[model samples]
Target: MPGPAPRVVFLGLDGATEAVLRPAFERGWMPNLEALWDRSATGTLWSSEPMVTPVAWTSFLTGCNPPTHGIHEFHAIDPAARTIIPNHAGRIRVPTLWDAISESGREVVSLGLPMTYPPPDVRGIVVAGSDAPGLQWAFAQCPEFGEEIFRDLPGYSHKVLWKRRPRTLDELRSVSLRNREVFRAQAGAAERADARCDWSAMMVHFHNLDGIQHRLWPYLDLDETAAHQPEWTAEVVACLRELDEAVGRLLELASRRDAAVIALSDHGFGPCRALVDVNGLLCRAGLQRRLPYGTRLSYRLSRIRDRFDRWKRRRSPEGTSRRGPRSIEGEVGCDWSRTAAFAPFGQLCGSIFLNEDLVSGSSAAGRTIGEIIDALRAAEDPDTGLPLFADAFDVAERYNLDPAAEGLPDVLAPSTDGYQAMAKWAPFSRSLLRPDPNLPATHRYDGVIAIDAPGVSPDTRLDAELPDVAPTALALLGQAVPEFMEGRILDEAFDRDEASIGTAATGGPGIRPARRPIG
Candidate 1:
């Protein structure tokens, strides 16, 4: 007979990267993280192809690629309904880590995990993150837990207002501070829950780091000779220090429960130099249709009105407000009937959708796709003569996509730079590529991951990918790794016998006949 299984605690820091954390750790700004890295196996956790939050985290949870998990991007388009639905847990086709662990008779508590909105019916407690519109329906197993959180913590928010751009440094500081406070409260709540409940695994996610990087990347990445240095840099540093403290607290909690600790991020972060309007290019190629003359006139007038309104707001005593930028789709409506191919907005990639109605047959659609791909490949920056897109993928060939999947895009357009591909079909005064003043930071491919467990080798450097995390975690819990999962366990990070404990099982959720004993 084997002893009891070790509890596992996963701390997900959104957009955490070695580029930021390495410097902070070396400067002694993050002692807890430094200590964990010193004693644990640390490595770069590669993100998904487009490296968006939803897709990467989904890959982390499912041990499967985007195709198997069925989450290719943030927004899934419904062609028949002509609507875009936000990705959520309901969209996940495979069983997640939480489901497997809970089914093995271990209690799990997940707090503030993204893409978990409309929380699944697990054997344990789950509180959804950003996708939930309100705090009321954030929790699935425990409604009172959310109520207690709201009542206890003042200015408690499950998700920060990421879309809103700060007009002033003070406004940015205010938002960052509020989000930091919310993270602190959530971390404290997670610690308490772990202490009270009989949980085998507890996962907590923090989004403030990602928010701060997005809003203050200009200041954070500045040199001493920069033209203007905002006073809010100190606040950003303070928020990071607070995050470090939260890690320390969680580490202590994990220690008390005799749990192994794993700290990781879904994706990395970097400065976004410019935005590429892929839809505008499509319009130029005559692939995307233009609005009617009357509609175009109305749109021009609306833009004038909007500019006037913004000018008035800037001149007002209050100065500019923090309203988010309007969606390009809403601004320039797509004429689907005449359009052949159109790129839809995503975080760091634009998914090009072919209009099936416009292209009658499959052969014609293939020809249109080939033409669009050729055109995009031929496109070059007039100023630098550089390729606009880093890579373009045929969805069906690259991802082994299900041909029958609804709302699937035809092509994926990832920008050469880390900027988002904007879907703007209308012509504008600026060049095709221009600096996005509103959003200065975006995601990168190399995320951060650190694992510290008993019997695991110390000071080890492991090479890992996003999908590998789920199976490694399952192996830690002595659960069988599903054969359908595409990732392999990190044998280098653990002792020989421990690493070999996982058995590959086929079939679905009911395939696990019995839980393996903890080695």
Candidate 2:
């Protein structure tokens, strides 16, 4: 009889770092994860520069860098259009792991995978996560995937539970509890579908750990006077422990057969308090101009929108802001010259794309722009004293840099901890960060990684090539890793005892194969 085809399952914990999980697991906070770690070979999964969600997860899934996949930050740039496009839908140009599997006639289910706004044409169920406005519309663009399946799931909202309300001590605890339950429900639904399907690959993502870590990190000082507060330490542990229990539930649902179960996070988390407005800094650097008084700009035309929203909302119309209050316009266009950069989330640090029309007369302007970005990266703040930014890079490494790709930023900025860059059209932004003496929350870059499965090798590190995840999965499934895949297949994680899977025309370390661009 033929050997059973391997089944694969991936659980992505956004912002889960070893920093928190290590201590939490030591205290028995994550028993199931600990069990998985005990059985599996695990190591740190390092991320690319600007180590944020959209880029890291996209790289993992597509086996390509931000340039090749067309996602740098949570936002993407169309160089020709000179516009900042959000990384909604599968705008990635490379094929994802699920797409490869489906092509081979295997089934796959993807839930809450970032940048999967327009769900791709997969062989199985897909529920795109990350609330992009055009999520349903993007899915509709794909004629292959059943639009009905996309409709059944909730729209791509970043965090349903944590963002339900702002961070309050009570709200934090409640969100933690509610998040565990919600994750359980979602995982259960996916597992039920798994049972009915003949062959399957499913990815489930949880964002609560990252959310809790964001708010609770500063309060985590072990030697503090408030150390005993559950909200400080015990409460944090409880949240992680609850996530552990949810993991246990899912493990129970999966078959013990040659099924490959892997638990991973996109990147770790760290502490962030005040947002550093990079645009304000760039304005000081002579990179951005300010809006002159009495000048009309699309983004500046917000007063009219505000008035209209307020006037219509007084009637309590059916379609308006879900939470009733003074209405705010969703978006505004900008006088690009007056804006240096904008921070989208706590992660996006800066935008250094050049203005073609503005600098058309300058000699070798792109090269000069590169020099400016390099200097900004090495700069430091004078007062509070932090790196001007944590990391900065150009898209040349991975992106082909199409001449027609407009609005492509020349540089990407990730601020030092406790800082963020903001774009113009921002209402209340500071030129520099001030000491927010009262705020208690923080952001951290250290997170957790635990692997539990029979196929994994002990003491293995998969960070050598960040793109190895997809090839690693294909290896376990006994499929070949295609050539033209920029990443190396993780051979260390697999053992000699495992029978050889079929080899791709380009399988193995440091091998590139011919592959077509994904539309």
Candidate 3:
């Protein structure tokens, strides 16, 4: 019979865009990636609706839409508790690609993939990434493996602190250098583990490119004023060059194993100029309530004090100190008792949730939702006079959402391609839209995907949605594409004879609804 099916190596580059990669490859900074692109089927990969990390990566992993996967954003709001919880791997309702592969008795190795914290019970090793509770305990399958791997490669961290701004070039250098080390270490661990383990599929995700893009986009595409800062620009280029080196190393490992290699990004990236506080708009419309004067005053003072502390630290020789992300929801002064509807902070997609209890006895829920939708659609950027929200969806009606789905937002407000919905609730003194200080670069919908394998055509254009990655990977391994997966195999990438082979496994019992109680 045929020798063991060719192994698959998937490299996930978070927030990579053709806009950036094309130019980088053309400049020869990424020679290995350019070589792969020349020989592979490549094209833009469509992302999830919101195009955020958790949602888009989950879709890529599950081969299903957000409605089917049940992960909408980074944080899910509990209507009853009036609190938001971090979204993690446990939030995924459907079986993942690794789960299916492992079920077929294939050993899998997954490293540094987002939303994989509290890692699933897979047949092989899993070291969680961004959403893990703590860096020390990010691994699930073998807890001690994390420490062992880090011992072999010191200075390994799953995440870099980005909430605070770097005050000096040295601070920025430190951040970028640490990030590079972590990424290289993670890839090194994956290479060593794959060599030692009995594995059919291995995936390694690198977030450094995305982090650098977010923090240094302005420097990367410098204006005359920013061009004066040569150090910043040079540092950004160095980080990118290091990223190319890491990609080259991974490709080398894949080739050594004779494995098919696929490289993809969850979403693209672009500069973000303004912030649109959706909750502030709702409060202005009387859809949400503001806190009492005294409470509001106290909150404002606390914010001032915090800013002062940050300022003091920046002035010190230590430069900027790393701080955990402060909750935007806590800054919102909404009075839930009188609130009919509110959008929580911290997502590009502005999701509005209705207080079901407050509206329980009223028949005006539909009318209220309609009014909110109209208001959001009418919202315009005062600076450019363009509409803030491109489209609004009643999630239940649009996505065929089950009424019982937990933490389901009643409305989803999607911004235009270049814009992002701001979740802060504080009132704007001048214009409703203002510059986003923390994040200069944000996500875009069209990410990049390139596939290279034995029968795949060279430089052929492949039209693929984000969900198709799972089925395509499974098909490449000669495994059946699960019937439950909404995505189809990307047959166009393969030769006519190779494409004709059967590769659909009957889906096991259809998707099971999440058991978590719906508010």
Candidate 4:
């Protein structure tokens, strides 16, 4: 009989961009990853539309487009109830890579992967990702491992670690230090768990890359030479050094298991200058209605009650772990009765729901999706005479989305470069557009993908996108690629004389829609 099937290890580096990676590699901050890149088949891995965490990572997990996966934003909006529930693992509609791998009678492991909260009961261990409410009891599908993971891994915590970005070198140092420890903790968790489990496939996600960049992009931007403060730059260097060591450790594990190693990112990252409030644009266009003072005050009171309820629950013995569907509605202060359209979710990329047409519309306010799209596309800045949006399209038409899919958007209108789009205005913002105080970093379309295995070519280019990861990973493991997968097997990446072997190449790699000329 043939030897055991080949193993595969998928490493997810969230929000990694070449802008940072090339510099880090050159600076010797991430020497391990640099060494791996020297012999790997690498190229840009473009992210899903919107290029946000929940959408892109979910695509990587499901091997499907955002519409197919039914995860377009960080929250799922209920049109009828007017509530916004946090998006979690339960929101994924299709079979994940883990689902396919486990179904093929192989063990797998998923660590620190976002959008994986409310862990799936698969054939192997699944330590929930950053999206989990808290790590206490909801950290893993196997409850036994949760406490051990928390105890063994030092400084382990989920996303949302800070209220604002660091303003000074000292503040940046504080954030960067914690980030390095968390990186070490996650790497430690994966290492410790691998010692106990028998697995053919594993995916470990390092979230610190994105968090640090989002909070400290300017100091790290390869461009802008004068902005690189020596002291502040050292903090970023320390964090990346930990990442390099973590990469080396995981690579060693892969070598021992004789596994094909693949490292990829959910999305790219860059500095953001302005904030584009999509709802403010809608309100100015007379499509959405802000609530009256009385109603607005009532919503504020409800918010206070919600916070109190959360505080009270934390004090109780039940703890923060709750295994159930998300119940809180979105806090979008809109008058549903008169609202024709509203952008209740999406960050960096705004998702618009045209009242009943997208599930949350009021019949009294009649509007066609086309009319709204035209209005958004027509929005311009008064001072600069520039368009607010890069592009606004009816999502159903663009992605060929399923008409029956719930929690999907009617339209996707992202801000142009130098601006981060939001569904609603900040509480005290006076205008639709304003400079970002936090200097927030936002996602870009070009991420990265690199594959290393015996048969694969060394340093060969392999340009692909988010959806390609799943089927390719399945193929690499000597498992059958499912028929539903839209991405190709990357047959070109492998050596000849074995073309279309166990894993057949379906078609060409997926390409995002071409970009239009910017203003």
Candidate 5:
């Protein structure tokens, strides 16, 4: 008989890539991950269409596409108010992996997973990641238990590691020190969770690596001067070494539970050479128009909720603001009647929202959308003669959605390699392209996923996307995959399956089985 069900441990390395990991492993900076890599089935985990953290990680949690889960980007647009708002834990339209596990008479200890602000009520421990306003609001259960960890863990935070970009070696050191502190805190929290509850499954996410790669890409890459700087190199190595130590501790815990360990990332990392001004291109192409009565009371009225939210966040116990994004669209008014389309917001990829009424009930299959796609595809940097968008495709078609579906963008434009979308729209904004003055790197779709467990083939290759992680984890844990999930179990990774894994689940709260005639 099967000895209960195999436990699972998920370790999320946010924005991790082979370019960095292979090198870090070769240097022996991350011995723990290297050891796991040696025995696991490794492959590229394709990210969401946008390849952004919020969208990709949300997909990982739900095992559903953006349309099914209802989160396409980090910030969602309140269609009624036409106001942009932060996408939070409450926005998920389906049951998450944690919920699925708890519903199956099991418990989960999910720590610091992205898009988990205002943590949901679950059977075991759950804490918010970068989305929470503060730790005060991050706990899902046992407030007293979580508060103890928060108080004891030093330099723990749910926001950016560095307040400013590290421009010098000294600044990099400061960022590294703070990052190591955060790593220790999260690792400590994982340790404490075991003493509190015997969880069936556990997931620990480390997000600082993404920020580090983004702000310190030059130093990580072979930039000659930046790579050769001993002080800066030392700081990077020290910071990642601390992260490796923390991950090693968790891997030890997995061994104690005899759990199958799965390591993954939301997306990979790469250097950013330029920023594509999304809105600037739209305005220049005569797709969007500005309001005649520019920035005034009307603009402030639309953003009053954001103001109130900020005020409320400030008054929270931690006093740290998890502020929603404030972009030029909120400050500058738009002439909706005359505008055919507008860019709400974006980072790695651009999102374009067409005027709903103008486009009628047809979603991505609209004449205006086609014209805009043509215009976007034709755009090129006059200075460098390089195309702005690497690919411009319909989100609905890409995600295989109903043409009449709502709450999704009409088109998505992804920048070419080494380019990121900057949806800047302001009265004074100029040019279709500009030098990115902030982070030097951005995300790619080549995130990683590796599973190390008994009976799994060594050195096996996995071909999967973000949503596949959750379903595969469920299958490994002896649970039926929710029927709504589009991903399937990676049967190739396991050699001892007797055809019971990857079965579809029946009706549940977040899922309603479709009607079918019995034979």
Candidate 6:
């Protein structure tokens, strides 16, 4: 029989930050996580630029940057059409550990982790996260388990999605319980899957902590009374405590001495006091012309307002209220056809990539594109007179830009720390620039990384560079790092006494890029 297969469990807590977590522990909200931190090697995990979920998590999975993975931001613009494509649409170009483990004949269970949409053909079960509605139902259609998993979820998703939409202190407590219930079901399934399979890695991503921070952060600071209410503090603490209990439940499932367990977050959370309107700034600098003067502010206001209306509409019947027709304003300088390179980072910021046909060879289009980037880089902030972006990276210098990707955008514009870019054709608003001086909690760069087992560093500090996490996981799994993965494998995380696992080159077994159909 093969030597005992190491069981690895990754608990991904979305938007979990050490700032809130550390304090919450002091107050006894997260005793389980605090205990895990003390027993395991723990430190702040750094995330890549734009610090959004999809970008950071994708890098965490593939161990490659957006350029190499072809997922630059939440939204990617087609260089030729300049139209927005869903950030969640593309497949990862590189191999992921899920693929690697499956190739080694190990089974894995992934629950509620994003970007697993159009699920990969792995050796185990993969249920795409709840972000995609009816995901369990969708996965049920997969030939793998047939209806086994789906048969159990309809009764669960109600408590999973709605019961946890906390609105009050009492509701917060109830949400916690609901989250625990969902986790219990998911964890039990994972354990059963592990027992039946040879080797397994189960990942569960929890979002309760993130929801609290987003709604309550503005009100936590007593200094800022506008957004704060007296009832929010206790609710935040309760949310943390709830997460701690969920952690305990997960730990119970894999308490094996040889099993390796990890709890990690893609990035941490904080208050959003400052909001930079990049599109507005660019227009003021004359780099981008604003919508024609007649353009109404409603066009901009509608973006924010429509979300609430849509949510209500979804909850209410289709035509209950006097719903007015949605309006569309015109673009000033944007050429929908010729404009290549778009920013798709959750509307928080933008990044650009070029199209294939336009940027290849001696096309004048490619030359025009380079000039556009140069112009963008030179553009300055009208108010502060500072550069529009932090820095622009060449595709070759900063990313694994496709060699044959000639028409892809040649430049990638990553925003400054707090400043994010957007490209809506509307007049700029300074009101959007004002920072929330009253925010109690604020966003920080600190993330969570916890590991337990033999051969790993007991306690150590880790570099925040996005490249480090993947190589670190590869090193732990006894896999050789590919030269294409620019990040260095973290050798320091292991102890010399622990025998290094075999380095057999098990090429990843999963989907490869589909060939374009020939006419």
State which candidate has the highest lDDT: 5
CA RMSD, predictions in order? 6.9, 5.9, 6.0, 4.3, 4.9, 7.8
Q: Estimate each model's TM-score.
A: 0.86, 0.79, 0.87, 0.88, 0.87, 0.73
Ten contiguous residues minimizing lDDT sum, candidate 3: 509-518
TM-score of candidate 6 relative to the true fold: 0.73
**Model 3, residue 184: C-alpha shift (Å):** 1.7
| lDDT scores of the candidates, listed in order | 0.72, 0.57, 0.74, 0.73, 0.75, 0.55
| lDDT score for residue 356 of model 6 | 37
Model 6 RMSD to the real structure? Answer: 7.8
Supply candidate 1's per-residue lDDT for 155.
54
Can you tell me which runs of candidate 3 are displaced by over 4 Å?
A: 1-5, 222-228, 295-331, 402-405, 425-430, 501-519
The sequence of per-residue lDDT tens digits that candidate 2 reaches over residues 93-205 is: 78888888899998887766666766677777666665433344334433243343344433222354554323576766666666656566556556655655655567777
In candidate 1, which residue pairs get closer than 3 Å at backbone N, Cα or C atoms, i.e. clash? none
Candidate 6 clash figure, as a count: 13
lDDT of 3: 0.74
lDDT of 1 by residue, 419-499 (tens): 567765335433667877767777887898898876667767877888888777777677778766777666567555542
TM-score attained by model 1: 0.86
> What is residue 213's positional error in candidate 5, in angstroms?
0.4
Q: Rate residue 409 of model 6 by lDDT.
A: 37
Question: Candidate 4, clashing residue pairs?
Answer: 83-329, 84-329, 84-330, 355-361, 356-361
Query: How well is each residue in 213-308 modelled by candidate 4, as lDDT tens digits?
Result: 777776675765226577877777888899888888899988888988889998887767667888888787878778765667655766676666
Candidate 3: the clashing residue pairs are: none
Task: For residue 196, give model 1's deviation from the true position in Å.
Answer: 3.6
Relative to the unseen true structure, what is the C-alpha lDDT of residue 397 in candidate 3, on a scale of 0 to 100?
Answer: 73
Off by over 4 Å in 4: 1-5, 160-163, 291-295, 312-318, 321-330, 335-338, 357-367, 380-387, 396-405, 497-519
Pairwise TM-score winner, candidates 4 and 5: 4
In Å, residue 213's CA in model 2 sits off its true spot by 1.6
